[model samples]
Target: MLYEGFESRESFDLLTVLKAFIRLLQKSPSSRIINVYGEMNEYDSDMKSWTKLFRDYSAKFELDKLMDQFYEEFTNTNIKISSAILGNDNNIQTIVEEADRIVHLAILPFNSSPKSKTMRILYGIVGEGMGRATRSKVTLEILLKEQHHVKVVVSNRAYKFLHDNFSKRFPSCDEASEGEAAIDIIKIEGLTMQYVNNVFDEKASVLHTMQRMPDMLNKNLDAYYKNLVSWMPQAVISDFDSFAYIFAKIHGLPILSIDNQHIVQRYVIPEEARESNPIAFYTYKCFVKAKLPRCNTIAVPPILRQSILDAKPLPVEHCEYFLVYQSSKSDTSLISVLQAFGEKCIIYELGREEKVDNLKFKDFSEHGFVDDLACAKGVFDNGGLSLMNEEVSLQRPFLSVPVENQYEQVLNAW
Candidate 1:
């Protein structure tokens, strides 16, 4: 999956897309499955209990030996691991070129800032969704279920996660790997992090993040051409985070912009609802504008278009109260405004270790939102692509509170 994009996380979109794809696959009588990813953190809280239960009874093994045991189990199955490509080397031309056959999908995660007009325009072109690898994997699984032969090449980190969670899915892939021809891989070295410092640096500003992008496009293009070139990419199937769509376009590939469901949920609600509840509308709009643009543009099958439209309608029941979460960087004034309603208001502050004694308050840290949302009456949160999508997939009735200065796409998505 593309890890860092307009917004960094993609866990939410991954769950939703997977759920939809899995349901589709189950309906088919016969299917095969192949999966790929970057780094797979098996011990993450979401999968902790499943891993524990699998080990305690289904397959007795020690916690520390999980990786080895997991790999061994897959090796004993029909799945194949032609060769493990370990690092972010973009230079694997030899291996990629030598493949007698190839099925390619690109995955990336993105969230956008509403305050940035450039981002909004970019969304109109690229759209939003989950990472490229993930969408490809889901697509692959569906094809496999149709009894088609499938193979996958993924980052080392993501490979381990799949091995642990889906080792038994493809018993024959193991044999297929052995039959494949061997080839050398060219490695591109380094992991350098770059950031723009100015609030309005042409390239760094949210609007121009893609417009001002230089490296993705060739140097000789006209100004408009350069802007469009930023999102172009080369893979057969690409999952572009925010601006990466520019690269996908240049390379002549189909792009899927993956992100959370809330990005699309806000615009779906009725105008009456938005007017009657100004606070909710304002808050929700803020989130969408601030973050949703990152996933503004996405490529979807025609069959899925109606489903996307369906996401906007408000749930049948209206919640009595709304719970607003305060992240580490939250404004104190906002906290005070939320707590003014007392117990009738549910407020959570993330990051601070200390808990408040006030009856109307609750402390929800970075990790706490996961469990609390499981039983929440209703939720009000940033239009983060990862969390919001998971909430929708879980069938929760919720409202998105996107940050104001960014993410206009989220505001318009519903």
Candidate 2:
């Protein structure tokens, strides 16, 4: 939506940009440091006279009140300003040094540039499957492309995956700082479900949480506060992760819930996905509903990797093998069944180091996995929404054996 001082749909003035920033800060009311820059060489008079230069410029342009609001709004952001003009002082260099955000104004005047935005965001991912990490990889890359500072709070395999993928590009990603690539990660204990003989064990799951939740939460708090107090995030994005949801609630941050699990809670379940076990489904649904129950949540569609879009899935007649994925690594019965079929099969997440018969047990890699999926005749999976979305996109046929008692997967199957 275009606001005032936006000459058209795309362009905005410097005063307008400052006003917008102030308005955004006022609305969100979080810790931040912003450095509004202009054409560097334009103010070439005296290095120490920027205050006087902008004061004269402000008077000529009649931008006193808006500038005042801008200065007043960000006074608590840690840099003290004694000079009224341009809101600069002896410590003006500190603004550039410690800025959490930077805005570049067009030189010579206004309305010459677009007012685009980025944010300091705390991203939280649930640490169970590869789906959340893979989806987060795409979004995180997008965020880094737009120069948004992101600090991910995650644990388990998700942490390992992200750390390995991002370690090269952002070598100093251990802390959230203002730069070309600013990313930090805090390892926190994430939820894990219990499986008994390939079936979701609700009692064991509840018991696991009851036994581990307190220590996990304590460790999470200790890790987050100890490592990231200065990394004040303006927003939070939760991949159906309870830690992020709770952290947002505690810190009064706005949450963007990005996951397919929210479908049954926020939207409706398909009639085709009718519950096989009504009591189990109800219990699981209640748990999902309680995880991040709130009035205000930003919903987004399921995030898919670029490879999913690029894949051109071949037909069963022309393909050589079948692809199988099991979230439950304990499901050895599936291995026996696939073996009995006496066909070449590719398997994932069985933690196997070698091939068994014709079953090719491979380690997880995004490119390799997508390549296999593109050539595979069919898929056998546990009804993860991510893989299902990929299947739909690639037009691949699949058999879904959803985890028992988890309504989200059950709903995804249909």
Candidate 3:
């Protein structure tokens, strides 16, 4: 769909689109579906080869045969579908002209913003974590500034974080007058991580997600389809969200993909680093590569907030505290570890919301965190790419203990 198979509730944006497309298909089985396969970015040499193979095969064989080959080589399950190859440039416009309705992925380009007199866009983002949401915020800001009518689908912590920020930044965007605003947010079901003894519990998390998935899927599908049919989008833009991707595939709509994960997929890993953990490294590389849709233009923009970019780093001598940022407040192990250092170093714990002991635990505020981080001696926390990047950008030492059983964090830490 947007990239590949649906993973979790984080991808509910994509799921909604897919459900809408299925409904359309059920109503009209004779619909002429023109699937357009997107090419991978130029930098991803390995994936580029696969793209070339698909392109060549599509050129040599019929649509059915090419789709069959695609399923055999790439996907685990067989999907009876046929597609045509369209060159990357202005693919969205082409799809809009041909298809009755369109759904596609969202990407924010610095040089050009989406402008249309006839196109209705549905933008999807994975909202389980803050990294995607943070990047989406910047993108949404640009879209709204350009006056693009975008319907945003998000869930879990991301929905609250985005809604709160948007409310403060654009007070006119309140539900009382959604039509007057350039953007509208729709809440959906999203996955929640499980933690045991302050570490991510993968098995428990998977079991919990599985248990709720059926109900979540049914409810979200119904809601998404109803919205999709009502809004009648002309295109879709996905940030590695599968529901949008699938919707585009089934309906033959133009889609664009944009995310930071592509940097990992495209960048050449050093031989030494690959050798260090060959299995993990390769697994992660393949996982990221497969997760994204094979789009013609895969834009990998730098993911950093303006605050992090503008804030000046403090001098090493003046830096005093060991700044701690935890996603969960329930994790006392991290608190205990930081507290052991006692008054030797001021332990500033930024978590959900609280105040305990010498550790100053509080809710996350962009300006407040940046101000504290500017004067921090070091950052102590789990391996989240956003914080790690900030610490490195500021030239501060980072001591990361990745959440257990979370391979993504483990890879980030490495």
Candidate 4:
């Protein structure tokens, strides 16, 4: 910017700088140009006097009002920005088709364009259990169906599950999106709980998290700066995932909390569901509130997988056997107790040895599992909110054995 007195000064070649700036703006619209040529890159209200030197400047010259006109155009919802203005059409076809342009914060693109109803979303999920993963899968598919570009940040089992599901279905955005869409799944470190004898071990879980904090921070930081910044999402969706929530806050982006866990903080619990253990209740409340206290929260019923949603469940009298699904591997006495019942029971425990009489151990497959659940007389589960909601949806009679000392699961069972 020039000093106010510079109009009368002959100390600098101001014309040369102004012309260079014009050339730079013609090539690319970036703030980087101002930074590159330091001192005097600015608009001068005094420059109107230069029209006296060039008589042609009066011919449709709106140089003095360029910014005002651009602002008006940018703010006008009716103006349509050309695809050419964004980039190579083939490379950013998805973005172009959606008409999403370069923007800062939540503002419309500076270029003249119609805004889109759909958005680019940064979605995060907790990797500890399959509950969050299963639910988020449905949400992601819905977003993709709506043609919203998404980038998922997760870790552990959730990362692998989502990666496998999305990779085969949609290739990278750099490639063509023939009739289908694509996504980028960026993995980061996440936390998990420790269980002993099918009970939550708070001490061990705390220690594990403390030890892994450094690795967690490093991976999240790398993903944040490298992939997340370039993606520049307009909104963030978190399913009990803190990393995504923090990212949304830092970038001043709108966030939508989509998870059942928010029921504790966002809803009124019945007296029966209130804390039997008060200390545990307040502690868990503090934790959940810390992640998302001010965001828009949508407390939804369990989002079931497509298979379960479409299944036709059978009655107990017509069904052949019951199903057993465990989220914890530390259930030492559960199989023995089931075996004593002397009725047929199907279970999933990957490395367990098989026994003949009453129990059947089967490898995990989505089709097989859904089929079993549909025909089962009942279910025995560790009270994962996702599967519990599935059982509820089917109206199947089941017994829930929630993990001890785990407030979320206890409330879920309640």
In model 2, the runs with Cα more than 4 Å from the true position are 1-118, 171-179, 271-275, 295-301
With candidate 4 superimposed using the best TM-score fit, by how many Å does residue 182's alpha carbon deviate from the native? 2.1
What TM-score against the true fold does each predicted structure earn? 0.34, 0.70, 0.63, 0.72
Candidate structures ordered by lDDT, highest first: 4, 2, 3, 1
- Candidate 3 stretches with Cα past 4 Å from truth are 1-119, 167-181, 275-279, 296-301, 327-332, 343-357
Model 1 C-alpha lDDT per residue in residues 357-405, reported as the tens digit of each score: 3324554332244445554556666554444554565466666654443
At residue 355, candidate 3 shows an lDDT of: 48
What is each predicted model's overall lDDT from 0 to 1?
0.35, 0.67, 0.58, 0.67
lDDT of 2 by residue, 215-296 (tens): 5645665444433333446788988888777767755778887877756666665554544666756666787789878645
Q: Which ten residues in a row have the lowest lDDT in candidate 2?
A: 104-113
User: How far does residue 244 in candidate 2 sit from its true spot (Å)?
Assistant: 1.6
Write down the RMSD of candidate 2 (Cα, Å): 15.0
Count steric clashes of candidate 3. Answer: 15
Error of 1 at 159 (Å): 13
